[model samples]
Target chain A: MIEVSGLTKRYGPATAVDDLSFQVRPGLVTGFLGPNGAGKTTTLRLILGLEPPSAGRALVHGRPYPELRDPLLRVGALLDAGAVQGDRSARDHLRWLAASNGIGPRRVAEVLELSGLTGVARRRVGRFSLGMRQRLGIAAALLGDPEVLVFDEPVNGLDPEGVRWIRDLLRARATEGRTVLVSSHLISEMALTADHLIVVARGRLLADTPLAGLTARFPTLEDAYLSLTSGHVDYRGVA
Target chain B: MRRALAAEWIKLRSVRSTYWTLAGVPAAVVIAALLALHASSLYDGASAEAKANAVVSPLETVAAMIAQLCLAVLGVRSITAEHATGMLRTTFTAMPRRGAVLAAKAVLIGATGLVAGLATLFPAYFLSRWIAGDRPLVFNESTLSQDLPSLLAGASLVALFALVGLGLGAVLRNAATALGAIFALWYVLPMIALNLPAPWGPRLGAVMLANLAFQLSGDPPYPGALMLSPWIAAAAMFLYGAAALTAAALALTRRAP
Candidate 1:
């Protein structure tokens, strides 16, 4: 379980995430929805303790993230898809992350097969396509077999098959009683995958509701998301 | 902390630059030793004092310095590449403790420095002996003290530069600019300072790290005009490196990803 309370972050004159609070429970997939620059990424960073909160705190499994023993075993995070060293082969890339967490090389090979990256595992990450890099990122996240997983825009450039693969993978992990928090702009795909929704706009929480209620009230998930966030989105003039 | 160390080790092995840096030590040491050996033997017309002083000892220090650039680049690359590619956010997210992460990186760098020092010392010692003809170089007990300190100091300089490079990389986050600043501070500025007239000139040169480095080696134990004792100078350089690290950690940990 991930519990965040009164989380706030400000950048000089601009307040990025303000007084935000929410809980992401286990045994479900929680989709974090927000417009561009809505502080979705910032919120994840704060929760994972990548960046300190301006106010308040975030706890994972009843303890702060930094205080956790074997954090990789507790929280598996993929903040960006292409985070591996470009000159390193995909297999070597995963191997090091696994080693970092005391995970064996066998597990590294397992993630390689799981992510369907065994074929291109020997190829350098710099040469990978966007979809290939996405798989590598997911592979790294799953290396430690963590109970809570955080993915920021996992399906941004994936093909139809790749998208289906991730959807099934996330669902399977959730089925195993793991907590999953994924941020994405693809409301349609998220509608099918997410059990719960946390919507934000301009760094403020707008809605934290079940997916069924959102779809039942509005014709579709996208329509509901648009309605909730439309007012908060700023429209800029085209030059 | 153990896990973080293991993770950093994995990171060190995975990157090609790490190997490249390691490879440079031997290549540089061998080349510099050979060149110095050849020059000493060929210039027979030179004074006995010149010949004795002109042994491959100084060249080993120079080669070690050249090898350090590679290590510095590797050290900076360890964090900066992650920052440039946005991997550091993921690393912090995985590990979280700012001090632990920095500690892990420092351990890895120190281990690498020790290995690099050993590699350069042994080969340069023998190569100089071979090229300097029958007149023993490293066999003399008196010279061993000078040679060992120079060896250790050279290695420490490399490690120090690597740490400083990491700190600068953290502060600047741009590889090219950080490297440029390190190069100018270590090499260019020192050269310019050495040209001025003594008292002030030597004083100015004293602060010039390169000259300070040469003075600190003291193979023949030259008269001092520099800032601090060798140990103190070494400590001061490390302190500057630490400041860079502190700045970087503060900059990164406070800002949102």
Candidate 2:
């Protein structure tokens, strides 16, 4: 379980995440939906303890993230797929991360196979294509086989097949009773994968409802999201 | 802590730059040896009267400074490279205790420095001794036993550079800025110290890293310069590393990634 309460972040004079409170329970795919500049990434950073919160606190499994023992074994995250050391091979990259959390090299090989990266595991990350990088990122997130998984914009550079792979992966992880939080601005993508929807706009919570609950009242999830976040869109192209 | 250490060990070896930096130690010794050969040639060419006045400073001494620079670069690359590549976020996410992670990195970086120091300084000692070939160089007058203390102190200084570079890297978070400060300290500041007015010149010079090994080993860099007692010089060396590390620790733990 992940709980965020009264969480706020301010950079200088501008507030990024403001007085937000929410809970992500286990056994479901919780889509963290927001438009651009909606503070989705900042909130995730706070929850991961990458940034100290300005106002409140975030709890994972009833304790703060930093306070947890073997954090990677409990919480796995893929914040940015391209944030790897390009000089390292994909296998070596995972091996170090595993070593950090006391996981064995066998798990590194396992994730490489699971992500279908065993063929290119010996290649340097700098030479990987975007799709390959995404796969490597996913492999890292699953390195520990944690109960809580967080993915930020995981499908941004994927092809149709890659997108389908992500959708199914998230669903499968959630089915195993793990808590999954995936953030994206694409409503259509969330419609296929998210069991619960937590929508926000302008750094404020707009809706925290189940997928079935919101879909029943609107023609589509996109209409429901647009109507709810009308003034909060910040920028839009002309029709 | 052990896990972090193990992980960092893997990190330290996997990067190609680490090997490149270690490779520099032998390469630096070779360069210094070539310079020594040139000095040896000059000494032989001079007339009998002029030969007595000519001096060749130990080759190991010259090479030690270069080795320190290489290790400092190694230290900076260990951390700042992660910052540049954005791998620090992933590291922190996996192990959120920023202090612990920083400590782990410092431990490995310092170890690399020690190994690098031993590798370069030891070989240069024998090579310089061999190259001088009874030419009666300034350092050649002393036997290996008499020079071991200074040589060990020199190796310690190299490790100190690694820590200094690492601390600056964390506090500065940019390789260019950290490396610039390191260069200024290692290369530029000692020259500026010598040009300063009396008392202060030798005083500052005495504390400068270039002079510490000599002073700590009971042989000041030069005559008439302030020569701190061996223990005091060692203490000063310790303080340099401690100050840099403390500053880096605070910088790393107090701020956001």
Candidate 3:
């Protein structure tokens, strides 16, 4: 389980995440919803201890992420697919990460097969297309088979088939009693995949409710989200 | 920490650059040693002073100087390449203890540098000795003993330069910029030190890496050169490497990903 309480992050005079509080329960796909610059990524970074929170705290399994004995076994995350050495083959890239967590080569091969990357596992990441890179990232996130998984924009560059594959994967992961938190701008995709929603705008929590409850007040989840975040968007284009 | 070390080792060896750099060290050493040996042979008809200068010193010194630059680039690339490719995020994410990660990188790279240094320096020394056969320099028990320390010093110098590169790479976080900084410090600054007036010129040259390596290896200091004793020079080079790594660790820990 993931618990975030009164979490806040401020950069100079700009507040990125303000008094954010939420709980992500196991066996559910929790959608972290926010408009552009709405602090979703910042909140994820804070949870992972990539950056210290200005106030409050984020805990994974009731302790800070950095305090975990074996962090990879508890929480697996893919914040950026491009955050890998391009010259390393997919197999080598995963091998090193696995080594760090004391994970063996068997699981490395298993994940490659599971992600449908076995064919290209030996190819350099520099030569991979964006879709192939996403699969590699997903393969890495599954390297340890943690109880909790976090992915930011996992389906951004995937083809239609790949998109469907991830949607099924997320649902299957949640069914197996894992806590999955996915952040995305695809409201339609989230509606189909997420069970719970945590919406934010301008770094403030606007709504935290079940998907059904959030969609009950409007015709669709997007309609309700637009209504709640209409005035909170950080940028406005010229009329 | 063991796991972190293992992971770092894999990361170090998995890249093509690592192989290129490791291979380049011996290639550079062999080529430089051959050239230096050729140059030494041409001193057959020179003055007694010139022959003395050529016979007493091993060609490994010149080869080591060239090899040190390659090892330094290897060291710098080890860390800077990670930063360049954003692999640092994945690395730090897996092992959140920032200092431990940096330490693992230092240990792995330093060890590789040491091994490469020894592998290249020994052969170069023996080859140079063979090439200088029949020269007035006698290979007595005392001279062989002296040669051993010099060989060790040359190897240690390679490792030290690698550590320096690692530290600078971590602090700078960019391959090109870090390489430039290291080049300036290793080559340019020493050149500038040569032209400076007294006391200061020797003082600066004394601490410069190349000069320190020379002194540590028991080579006669250049004219007007001021350098510490062998042990002190080794210690000083170690200190510089330590200082660079410490600064790198601080920068990594204090900065957000």
Candidate 4:
């Protein structure tokens, strides 16, 4: 389980995440929903200990992430799909990450097959399409087989079939008693994948409710989201 | 620490840049042989008085210098490439002990540099001596046993370059910027030190990184003999590397990915 409390992030005078607090429980696919510039990425970064919070703290499995011994064995995260060395082959990329965590090559190969990246395992990431890179990122996240998994905008570049496959994979992981936290700006996507929704806007929590509870409140989850997030969006096209 | 070291080694070996950068070792040996050929010919053509005055840079020194540049580049490439690509997030996420990761890089890069340096310097030392047989070159004046300390000292410079490169890469976090900083240290600092007025030139020049290996040999360094004792020069080099890595760890851990 991942716990974040009173978390805030400030970039100079601008507030990126403002007094945000949420708990991601085990055995559920928790959808971290926010519009663009909603501080979704910043919140994830704080929880993963990539950046120090300006206020409060984030905890993974009852301790801070950096304080954990071999943190990969406990919590696996895919914060960014593009955050990979283009020159490194897919297998070698996974090999080192596994080595860093004391994981062996067998798990690397397992994750590769699991993510359907075994075919192109020897190819450089530079030649990979966005969909393929996303798969590789997912492969990396699953390498440790940790109890908790965090993914940020994981399905962004996936095709329809890829999206369904990932949705099923996430649901399966959550079903097997894993704590899964997935962040996405797409409401409809979350509607199909998430069991619970933790919605935020302008770095502030707007709602934290189960998917059934949210869907029951309005005509559609999208309608509920738009109304909850009205005037909180940072950017919009002139329509 | 062991796991991090293993990971870092895998990272270095997986890339083509490591091979390219370490190519300096073999390249240095070949260059030394070529220079040996050039110098032996010069010695053969010269009159007795001219031959006595003739000298070329020592073989081990030249090879070690080349290896140092290459290893330094290897060190810089190791970290800066990760930073440039945002792969550091993944690395830190896995390892979390950011300092340990940097330390691992330092150890691996430093060792690789040292190995490359020794590999180049030893071969060049022997090969140059053989090629320039009975040529009365100044570089050939010392016996191998007597020259052993200087040869080892010269090879150590390669390792220091790699460490310095790693530290600079950590602090700078950009390949181009780190490379520029390295070039400034390797080339520009010595140039400026040489042109400084009065006693400052020799004084400053004595501590210059390029001169340390020469000083640490406990022999009067060629080109210009730096006055520092060998032990002091070794200590100064250690301090240089430690300072760079310390600054790097601070910059790397403090900065957000």
Candidate 5:
């Protein structure tokens, strides 16, 4: 399970994630819902120990992520679909990351097949389309087969088929008693895939409850999200 | 540490540029050695003192300079490629201890630099012996044996340049800027150092990592108290490497993806 308490991240005077606290339990998909700049990405970065939190803590399996002896074996994360070297072939990219965790080449091939990227495994990531890159990112994330998985905007550039593939993959992983925390702006997809919702806005926790409970309380999850983030949206001005 | 080293090795090998840059080191060394030998032959009629001090020294210095650029390019390419392609984040995620990762990268680059340097050294020696003209260009044990320190120093400079490049990339996190900064430090800094006043100028010259490295290798026996001991030079090179690595680790860990 993933536990975050009073997690806060700030950029100078601008707060990206503020006093956010939520718990993601095992055996279900926990959807992290927030509008644009709702601190969704910042929260994930904190959880993975990619960025230090200004306050409180984010724990994976009862310990801070950096403190874990074998982080890849315990938690797999895909913060962005394009966080990979473009010049390297998909196979080699996964191969290196796998080697970093003491994982073998077989695991790399396993994830390629699992993410449906086996056919293009030899191609450099630069040649990949957005959808293909997303698949490769997913392949990298699953290389360790960890008990907890964190994905930010997993379905951002996917086709219908690709989207369905991931939805099924996530559900299957969660069904196997693993904790899955996914952040996205798409409410309808979350409604279809997530069992629980942890909503935040302007870096602050707005609600954390069952998906059904959130939908029942606010009419639609979209409405709930808007109510939380509507005020703090950074409006880009026109000349 | 072992796992991180293995991973960095794989990362370096998987990319075409890494191998290409590594290949360039020996290529530069051999080509420069050949050209230096050819040029040295033109000065054959000169006096012994003139040949040793003026002719061979300058030629060897040129060879060292050329080889150093190749090493610097390799070093900059190693880390800047990650930043350019956004692979650093993935790397950090896999191995969160920032210092360990940087150290592993330095170790891998250093080993690769040493091997490349050693490879170049033997080939250059043979090529120089073949093309360097008569006047009894000694291929004997004594003459060839004396050159080992220079070869070793060349290798150390390559690794040091690589570390310096890694540090520059870490600071700038841009390939173009890092390469430019490295060029400025390697090629441009010495010229500027020459224009400065008295003791300050030579002292500034001493700070030129590659120049000091070249001097460190030349004629192991010391004639004057002004010369720095080889151990002291090696320690200073290591100190610079450590400083660069510390900066890289801090920049890498503290910065956002």
Candidate 6:
């Protein structure tokens, strides 16, 4: 389980994530919803200890990420698919990551096969297409088989087939009693994949409800999200 | 820390840049040394004093100078490339102890530098020895016994520069900027210091990297300049490496990945 309490991240005069408090429990996909620049990425970064929180704390399994022994064994996160060395082959990339957590080549192979990257495992990452890179990133995330998985915008550049693959993968992971936290701006995608929703806008928590409850309140998940975050949108272009 | 070391080793070896830098630099140095030795042989009418000077200060030192840049770039690329590719986030996420990550990188690059330094220096020394003909060379039996420590100190200088570059890469986090700073510190500043007027010229030049490497190799200071003894010069270079690394560690831990 991931727990964030009063998590605030500020840059100079602007606050990116403001006093955000929430819990992402196991056995369900928690969709972290927000508009562009709504601090969804910042919150995930804070939770993973990639950046220091201006105030408050984020804990995974009752311990701060940095405090956890072998953190990769407890938490798997894919913050960005572009955060990979293009020069290294996919297999080599996963090999080193596995080594970092005392994992072996067997696990690396398993993840590569699971992610459908076994055929291109030896190809340089620079040569891979966006969909292929996304698969590689997911393979890296699943290498540790952690109980908690965090993915930010996993479907951003995916094809329809790739999107369907990821949705099925996430649902399967959640079904296996894992805590799955995915952040996305696609309301329809989240509506189909996420069982619960934690909506935010302009760094502030707007709503925390189940997907069914949200859809029942408004005609659709998108309508409920737009209503909740309308005032919180940081930028609005002229129609 | 052990796992981090293993990971860093894999990361360092997996990149083609590492192989190109490590092998290519030394290969170029050896080839240059061979060419220099061949050219020296054509100096048919050179006086005994000139030949003696050539034997005492082998052209291999010049080869080492060029190799220094290669090793420095290698060190810088090891860290900066990760930042450029945004792989640093993945690295830090997997291994949250930033200090361990930095330390592992240092160990990997430093060891690589040490091995590359020795690899280049040994071949250069032996080749210069073979090319010296009947003339007495620095690596001769008596000189080897007397100057062995200084020669090893010279080899260690490359490793020292690599560490400095690694630290600068961590601080700057950009390849071009870090490389520019390294070039300024390693080459430009030394050239300026050596050319300055009077007391300041020799004084500042004494601490310059090239001058220090020369002094640590049991060579005289740059013409009419003051310099520390061989051991003292090595110590000063070590201090520079330590300070740079300390700054790098501080900068790394303070910022968000």
Candidate 2, B164-245: lDDT as tens digits? 9999999899999999999998978888888889978888898897788889898767667788899999999999999989
- lDDT, candidate 5, at A221: 76
In the order shown, the chain A TM-scores of the predictions are: 0.97, 0.98, 0.98, 0.98, 0.94, 0.97
The residue ranges of model 2 lying beyond 4 angstroms of the native Cα positions read none
Better of 5 and 6 by DockQ: 6
TM-score of each: 0.89, 0.98, 0.95, 0.98, 0.91, 0.95
Ranked candidates (lDDT, high to low):
4, 2, 3, 6, 5, 1
Tell me how far the alpha carbon of residue A88 in candidate 4 is from the true structure, in angstroms, after superposition: 1.0
DockQ, all candidates in order: 0.63, 0.86, 0.82, 0.90, 0.74, 0.91
| DockQ (model 6, Cα) | 0.91
Q: What is candidate 5's lDDT per residue for B1-257, written digit by digit as tens?
A: 99999899888888888877777756765675667566656667778776555424323444556666777777788888888776787888899887788888888887777676666665666566556655443332246567777777877777788888888888788888988988888878876766677677666766677666756775422122134567877787888888888888878877875
Q: Quick one: best DockQ, which candidate?
A: 6
How well is each residue in B90-193 modelled by candidate 1, as lDDT tens digits?
Answer: 67766777667877887788668657766776576656655665643433323565567667766676776777777778778889988998898777876666
Better of 2 and 3 by TM-score: 2
What is the interface RMSD, in angstroms, for predicted model 1?
A: 1.7
Q: Evaluate model 4 with DockQ and give the value.
A: 0.90
Q: In model 1, where do residues sit more than 4 Å from their true spots?
A: A236-239, B44-57, B134-146, B212-217, B220-257
Model 5: what TM-score? 0.91
With a 3 Å backbone cut-off (N, CA, C), the pairs that clash in candidate 1 are A100-B7
User: For candidate 2, what is the lDDT?
Assistant: 0.89
Off by over 4 Å in 3: B40-57, B136-142
Q: What proportion of the true contacts does each candidate reproduce?
A: 0.72, 0.80, 0.81, 0.91, 0.81, 0.91
The worst-scoring run of ten residues by lDDT in candidate 6 chain A lies at: A64-73
Q: What's the CA error at residue A118 for candidate 5, in Å?
A: 1.2
